[model samples]
Target: MKIGLYFGTFNPIHVGHLIIANHMAENSDLEQIWMVVTPHNPLKKKNTLLDDYHRLQMVFLATESFPKIKPSDIEFKLPQPNYTVNTLAHLQEKFPQHEFALIMGEDNLNSLQKWKNYEVILQNHDIYVYPRLNSGEIDSQFINHSKIHRVGAPVIELSSTFIRESIKNNKNVVPMLPNKVWEYIDHNLFYKK
Candidate 1:
């Protein structure tokens, strides 16, 4: 089995996320996409993140009906400042039978070289990059890699940062997230200032 590991904090799962996962699952060689619930991303600030378990729960609730997508808590038990290289290594060890690939947005592609042992990742694992806002116009000449593949997915402008700020300001975030996630956020007061 071939799996695409879509890593993210998923502070609150939104429609845009589901759309991407669905699009990839339908179009890619991947059999399934594991929503790797990142406990703490090395590149992101820790203070801005919600509790890992809370974020994981939101992913679980939002992707419940989607068979091709699953919530993975693999990073919760791993070391702090989670790095993609470490997570991929651990997952490969745990699920040796399944071939794993990295799934990310093109916005992160430019910074890929900064990631720990990024060269090793490019050599060993396949990468599926979705188009990001304003990056679609980039010429195909810029993308030159046998390991990298571009996905034809809808470019969604929605972001978790926007949703978090809305909650902090007491703005309605119902449209930003799924119904279950919105209810959970409202009930638990997540991101409240």
Candidate 2:
């Protein structure tokens, strides 16, 4: 089995996340896409992040109905300030029979050099990149690489920050999030002002 790891904070697991995962699952040779919910992204601020467990649960709720997509809590048990290369190493060791690939946006690819052990990640794992609006083109060095694949997933402008702000301002985020996710956020009064 080939798995694509779609790592994210998934602050609320909005529709844009789902769309990208679904597109990858259908368009790529991947057998499944695991939404690897990072406990803490070293590059991003942690003050506004929801609890890791809460974020994980919302991912599960949002992806439960999709057979090819799964929500993973793999990062929760791993060391904090998780690095992609470290998690990939752990996953490969644990699931030796399965082939694993990294799924990300073009924007992330632009900053790939900033990640820990990024060269190892590029050399060892296949990468599926979805386009992001205004993200510019991928670097020429990676454009023709066999390990790197560019996917034509729709460009969604939604962001977790935007969703949180909308909810705080009492704006309807129904269009931006999965139905169950929105219900969970509303019931739990998450992102309240």
Candidate 3:
């Protein structure tokens, strides 16, 4: 089985995240897309992040209806400040029969060089990139020798952070999240001001 690992903090799972995962599952050779919820991303801030378990539960709730989309806590048990290369290596060892691909946006594609052992990751795994709006043109030359592919998913300007802030400010967020996710957020008073 081939899997596309869509890694993110998913402080609160939202629609844009679901759309891309759905598009990937429907269009690609991938058997499923595991929303690998990172407890602590090495590249992002940690102060504002919610509890890893809580975030993971929200992801589970958001993706429960979709058979092809799964919420994973693989990184939660891994060492702190998780790195992509390490996570991929671990998953490969644990599931030797399955092939894994990296699912990310073109924005991250531009900064691939900064990731730890990025070359090893690029050389070992296939990458599926979805272009972000106005995130400058992708340089094909960088991954010329790597197995990188582009997806044709619709680009949305929405992000989890925007939805979080909206909820914090007491704004209507029905359109930004799934019904189950919105209910969970409301019940827990997540991101309350």
lDDT of 2 by residue, 112-182 (tens): 87899989998999999998888876677787888999898998889999989999999988999898999
Model 1: lDDT equals 0.87
Error of 2 at 181 (Å): 0.7
Model 2 regions lying over 4 Å from their true place: 41-45
Query: Compared with the true structure, what per-residue lDDT tens digits does model 3 show for residues 6-106?
Result: 99989888999999999999999888999999886656766668888889998999999999999999999898778899999999999999999999998
RMSD vs true structure, all candidates = 2.4, 1.6, 1.8
How many clashes (backbone N, Cα, C below 3 Å) per candidate? 0, 0, 0
The order by descending TM-score is 2, 3, 1
Q: For candidate 1, report its TM-score.
A: 0.91
Q: What are the models' TM-scores? A: 0.91, 0.95, 0.94
lDDT of 2 at 130: 92
Backbone clashes in model 2, listed as residue pairs: none
Better model by lDDT: candidate 1 vs candidate 3: 3
TM-score winner, 2 or 3 = 2
Looking at model 2, residue 47 earns an lDDT score of 75
Flag clash pairs in model 3: none
